[model samples]
Target: MKKDNKCVDINVSANVGECAYSRGSTPIADEGDAVIRVPVELAVLNIRTNLAAKIKFPEPVLEIKDIKKRVQIVQCKLLLPGVAAGTDPFVEGSYHLFIKGYVRKNIQYASPCYNSGVCVNSEMRSLTTDVPFECVVEIAEDDFDRTPQLPFQNARAEFDFFRQQDLGHGYPEKDHFLSSDLSQFHQDSSQFYNQMPYCELISSRITEWDEALDRKPFHNSANWQEGTFETISEKMFLQFTVKVLQNQQVRVTAL
Candidate 1:
């Protein structure tokens, strides 16, 4: 069905905090040859958005015809320790992060409203809703022995590219990974590193509905003929943590 309005753009704002890193166990191998995966979890305080969509009222009375839903993974980030190469027990404080994902858009609409005897169409409206997110925990390297699981399996491949580039090493040039130098010795704590990190929505969803609305008009108002009504509301939130990459399986060596 043709939509009365469509979302053209979306702006995301979020609050992040509470960051901790843990090490995973390396397989049974030599110290230099074994690989370990670190897990980190950041808390997601609050997430909000601003949307850009267009709508037009062709007639005086128009009811919602349909509803739509769109959910997608927007981005991913990997957290790492502040320790440089060849550090004794690995630095305790400070951290680094690697992010990768696609740019996306979000659109929302309210339930249809009515007027005096006739349904008065709406021009445009804005609304915001609070959502709950899952905060993945940070696991230590040795902990991998019991609970062995890697997060963000869907975006792992792309994240791997960002990992390689950050390591000051070269991955597949044809893959077009983002340019970022995060080598052990040349770490840039100025950019995406955080200590008390919070969880952020890496994926978002847009829901559209034509369901009926509950609204009442004010009779003593200036414009009584044009009644006020509530619009439809739809929301989706995906949360993941940025862990310290203290023990990651390197895909490529620095050149």
Candidate 2:
């Protein structure tokens, strides 16, 4: 069985936090200076799943050669600024902490069969045991007094765990045909323009016009009429202008 070419897999990890110690000394007149213990609190945060990986086709057809997991840390700050630093005692009170992990499953694509015009479909399996998960923690206003004791909580529900499944295979022949046509058009246009003597000059002038347009934006007209002839050019300048006019007309109709 033939397999599609494999691309390099990149693994990236995000930093969570570092542990640091703070020292404080108290002065005494009669006795020697006394040292006090100042314990640092671990940051607590919360995050929810906003986006999930799309299952290609009706199902996933790729094989999972390996699974990689990582945790991302998000920090939260107080809405009100200008407050004196170190005054906010609890780390949990100052910022919220959230963690999210990504799982990338590596799989090979089966080669297409030329004789029957059918592609050999195979399922992508996940070899990794750890699944991607998210966790969130919120520090209540009353929970701030006890410092040094980090208030870490498991927010993931038991039923919330998810695993990637292999869907069925798909034949992209139609997609390939459309893509080939687009490529041919681009190639022919390039060859024709390359043979033209004033191609460079025309392209340079177009670039200058594009830069000028960027400096001073203009709207495109969606529809226009010169006497009895109505023309609608799909140019950007015309389209923008036409869209504005259409919006105004819609507002007037509503009113």
Candidate 3:
């Protein structure tokens, strides 16, 4: 391999944590034959969107339970070569690290009301059924154990370049969801009722009763009198699956 003088050497290990996972590192050597003991630091990875794939939401429907949240933690090991013993205990040779793992979420919901009152009620509800979605990180020898390098002085510059060159491309600017968008959809009940039949007034009354009985939001409640009905269609459920797989692949390949 073409040696880059700027490269730094270090040792790394992977660990999973709540909300965020970390890869710990310890420096075994440094440039100039200096033995350096670098403190262990966590490697933080982010979940991101896929630029090449399009996420499709099932037609607007009131009744269906979508995946509220899905999170995953994965670990991979790397090995470094060319070590000089008796050097400063802190100094470490360089090593290259590659991470691989799967992250996915499955959202599932029944189709919305096509007919006003014939088969299902009009009150909008969150689908109770879960959509099964999964993302896979194909495990291979390449995922584990790799070379090492010296610590780059300009870590951010190196990281930006590495992300651009090695990781899969980022999502398009338009496709990237803003914080407001996420918060708007996450944990908000108003959005659900708006999609269902009948005005918010009727939906609200029905939801009140449903909450009293189940202590949970009604996913498919048609009206206060109609009770809860299945609103999510099979097609919508499949869409969630596709989203999970596609997103996971995009994240892994990019990393």
What is candidate 1's local distance difference test score?
Answer: 0.34
Ordering by lDDT: 1, 3, 2
Off by over 4 Å in 2: 1-39, 43-50, 55-67, 74-137, 142-255
lDDT of 1 by residue, 163-255 (tens): 433323465545544654445233222232222322354444443223324445556545654443344343333333222222333233224
Ranking by TM-score: 1, 3, 2
Residue 165 CA error for candidate 2 (Å)? 85
Judge candidate 3 at residue 181 and give its lDDT.
Answer: 27
Evaluated with TM-score, which candidate comes out highest? 1
**How well is each residue in 1-255 modelled by candidate 3, as lDDT tens digits?**
987885544434544556866985443322343333332231222223221222333344343344543322243333323223223222233323333323243545444445454355343333222223233332233322211232222111111111122223675544533233222222312111111011010110001011111212334545334333322223211111111100000111122
- Cα distance off (Å), candidate 3, residue 239: 22
Candidate 1: regions farther than 4 A off: 1-63, 87-214, 217-255
Each candidate's clash count: 17, 17, 47
Provide the lDDT at 164 for model 2: 35
* Error in Å for residue 194 of model 1: 18
